[model samples]
Target: MDALSQALAKSRQTISAYEDYAERYDQIVRHVPNEREQASLKRLVAIAGTAGQILEVGSGAGYDADFLEALGVKVRRTDATKRFLELQAARGKHGELLDLLTDDLGGPYDAVLALAVLIHVPRDQIEQVLAKIAGSLRPGGAFLVSMRNGDGETDGNYHTVLWRRDDFAARIESAGLVLIRDDFNEGRNREEWNTFLAVRPA
Candidate 1:
């Protein structure tokens, strides 16, 4: 197979392994609490200007979803991992299996939360995914995403792409979104991750 196809195949296999790993996946992760995640959620709430319908893509274990709901925001969660999706469903949470890399799932949300999820997307396809995410939001709606910050390449059984800050920002902007804030924090893995809060341009 070509290099791109090979990479995609490898990525799918890695993600499938993660599905089987379930909560145990955290064991391999840095176990670092994402401060950017906390900050971004606060900004999202502020941009939303009150409780409103929010869509969270890659809502692993529904942690952020539950957090948002607890904060009085209505949250609809979705993830690409079937096992993770099922786990969220089993908890009586609202969520679905969704692949942002694909076109249109549902839409016009007040805001879209995608913390730490985009890292799984292949670098070449990041723009496509971002565009699809932007389309899911209403004009002036916000989109929050976080990714590992690095100039080097890294692969994992689950994560396919690691991105640099400038490159990721350029793609988000090209998707017709305006970045409102960008923050970074040290991860438990000893790597940095960037969180971006953006709005679909009106």
Candidate 2:
């Protein structure tokens, strides 16, 4: 199949998976942030400042948003998945529906965060999405993203497109963001978890 066709198929798979999984997802994770997660969030808040406006894409159940809110950052939680938003609302958390591909980003915020979020975006859409992310940031605004690390793709319950650090960084830079942090945490599989912290130029 062609790239566009492949992407559509993947999106269908993920949309189905998340819709089915949203209720049970909190059982998998709804706890406090781990050390790594907290550190990254702390760094992001420090760069953006405590009172700065923040936007989170794919904010599943508002997990990351909880940490940022705890740090006194005002975060607008958004996810493409409706079920996730409903679950979040049930917990008295604020959220909005946002599709990275079709929806307006509507931001000139101090930071845009997508933790474990961008991996679902297909190859053809990554550049445009990243550019939108970069454009959504205020000057010198931070962009902290964590994506799966490797090459090629995976399709099953959800669609996953992994990446090499250098290659992904090139994409981020091309999107008009400057890389300031590059790190990885080993995962159970061969592909590690790659996290990049970048910022839109001031």
Candidate 3:
């Protein structure tokens, strides 16, 4: 199979596995939040404030959604996995099924938060997906993203498209979003992550 096709297949399998693990996802996660996650959430919520809606792609266990809502940001949570959406629904919050490469993300949202989600998008389709995300945002709207930083692709439980920092920045700007803040986090086992806050020009 071609690279994109292989990545899609792995994405499907990974989503299924995550669906099965949905109920236990939060429970199985480390009690201590990752510093990067906390930092990103703080920045996003601060930007969101009391006005405007935020769209969170790959909501997973809805942890970020919970934090944003508690901070008074109107958030719409979405994931590609059905069971994960169900878990969010069970918490008295609804979530939508969103396929970043295929689905329409109905929005001109004030902010778009996609933490560690685009890492799963295949390389060939990454630019298109980024454009689609940028198109969903309003002018001056923020896009907060975090993804694993490395070289080449890997597949196992899910597909990962590792990226160099400059190439990733180029992709973001090429999609018409200007970079605002950029940073990196070094983790255990060489798991370095790239975080960025980009915005559509007002």
TM-score of each: 0.87, 0.94, 0.90
Q: Write the per-residue lDDT of candidate 3 for residues 29-85, one digit (tens) a residue.
A: 544456777777777666655677999999888888887777788999999999888
User: What are the per-residue Cα lDDT tens digits for candidate 1 across 108-191?
Assistant: 888999877788777776777788888888888998888888864556666547778888899999999998888877876597
Worst 10 residues of 1 by lDDT: 25-34
| Best candidate, TM-score | 2
Per-residue error for 14 in candidate 1, Å, reads 3.2
lDDT digits (tens) for residues 86-183 of candidate 2 = 98899899899888877899989999999888999998889989999999999989999988988998877888889898889999999999999988
Give the distance in Å from residue 128's predicted Cα in candidate 3 to where it truly belongs. 0.5
Instruction: Report the number of the highest-lDDT candidate.
Output: 2
Task: Score candidate 1 by TM-score against the native.
Answer: 0.87
Better lDDT candidate (1, 2): 2
Model 3 poorest ten-residue lDDT run: 28-37
* Ranked by lDDT, top first: 2, 3, 1
Model with the higher TM-score, candidate 1 or 2: 2
Off by over 4 Å in 3: 1-7, 30-36, 188-190
Candidate number with the higher lDDT (2 or 3): 2
